[model samples]
Target: MSKLSEKASEYLSREERLNVLSTSNKAGENNIAVFGSVMAVDDSTVMLMLGENTTCANLRENPRAALLVYVPGKGGLQAEGCRVYLRLRAMEDTGERFEQIKAGIRARVGDAADMLKHLAIFEVLKVRPIIDLGQEI
Candidate 1:
C-alpha cells in the first residue's frame, strides 16, 4: 500500500472532487484547462479521465500536469492556497498498475461508474502540495 503525504491525505479526504489541469502543445504553445472528474489513486497518485480532447492531445505531447482540488462551500478560494501541483508521466494502458487506478476511481466515485467507463486514466508522477498556513491574506 502506498502511503500518501499527510497534506495529500487531508486534501483528498476533505474534497470529494478535483480540478485537473492538463497542458498540451499547440503550434509550439501551451494550452491548459480545468477538468472536473479527477480522482485520487492512493496518496501519491492522482487519476483523471482524458477524453478525446485538446487536453489529451497536449498530454500526448507533454505528459506533465498540475491538479487543484478545492474544498467545497464558502472560503473555497482560501482552500486554493493548498492546491497540489504534480509532474505527470503518462502510463501505458496495461498491467496491474492500470487496474489499480481503475479500481481506485471506482471506489471514489461509484455514482459515476457509467461515465468513467468511457474515460482514459492518467497517473501523477510527482506531487507537490502548497499550503499557506502563514498567509493572512
Candidate 2:
C-alpha cells in the first residue's frame, strides 16, 4: 500500500474535517451520506465504520466509493479549497483485520463503537484536488 500525501494525511487527522461518502447501488442509483466514522489505515487504505444501512447495502452490491474530504474553516465546509477526493475499490474481507479494526474503533470511539458492525476496507485507487486554487491548497 502506498502512503497518502502529506496534505491528505493532515486532513484525515483533523476531527473537524467534513466527509461525504458516495456509493452506487446495483441498479446504478447514486447515494450519498454523511459518514464521519472513518480512520486512515496505513497509507493506502481506510476503515469506514458502517451499519446495516443503505451505504452498506450499496457497497455490498458495488464496492466502488468516492470519499470527499473538506478542510474546515471559520465559515464551514467548502468545495473550492484544500480538499482531497479519493476513489476507492473495496478490498476482500478478512477476519483478522475485522477484529483489529473493531478494536481500534472501540479504542478511539468507546462504547458508541458497537454501532460499527462491519468494516468496509477500501484500496485507494486515486486522489485528486477538487479545485486547485493554488497556494498549496
Candidate 3:
C-alpha cells in the first residue's frame, strides 16, 4: 500500500475542504460527486459514507477511484490540495467505522443522516499535486 505524504494527509484533515470523488462503472460510464464526509483514516486509508447511489454502485463494479481535495487559491491554479488515487478496500453497512460515521452524520445533519447507506473504505494508491505537474505530494 502506498502512503500519502504528510502534506496530503494534512490537507485531508480539514473538515471544510471540498472533496470531489470520481468513479467509473464497468462499462466506462463515469460519475463524480462532491462530498463533505470523506476523510482520511490514516496515511494510506480513507473512508466515506455513501447512500444507495451511483457512486456506491460504481464502486461495487469497479473499485478504483480518485478523490480531489481542493482548497481555493488567490488566483488561477495556485490551489493548495492534492488528488488521491484509491482502490476500494471494503464496503460495510455495519461496523465500528460505519457506526462512527453514522453518529457523526446524525449529529451534523440530524434526520438527513438516515440517507447514509454504507461506509466505504479505500486504500491510497498515490497522491499528486492538484495541478499534476509531475510532482509528488
What overall lDDT goes with each candidate model?
A: 0.55, 0.69, 0.90
lDDT of 3 by residue, 1-137 (tens): 68989999888987658899999999999999987788889888999988999999999999999999997654466778999999999999997868988998899999888889999999999889888777777
Better of 1 and 3 by TM-score: 3
Candidate 1: Cα lDDT at 55: 70
Ranking by lDDT, best first?
Answer: 3, 2, 1
Q: RMSD to the native, candidate 1? A: 5.3
State the displacement of the C-alpha of residue 63, model 1, in Å, after optimal TM-score superposition. Answer: 1.3
- Between which residue pairs do clashes occur in model 1? 24-58
Best by TM-score: 3
Candidate 2 local accuracy as lDDT? 0.69
RMSD of each: 5.3, 3.5, 1.2
- Which candidate would rank higher by lDDT, 2 or 3? 3
Those runs of model 2 whose alpha carbons end farther than 4 Å from true positions after fitting are 1-3, 74-100, 103-111, 132-137
Candidate 1 local Cα displacement, residue 42, angstroms: 2.3
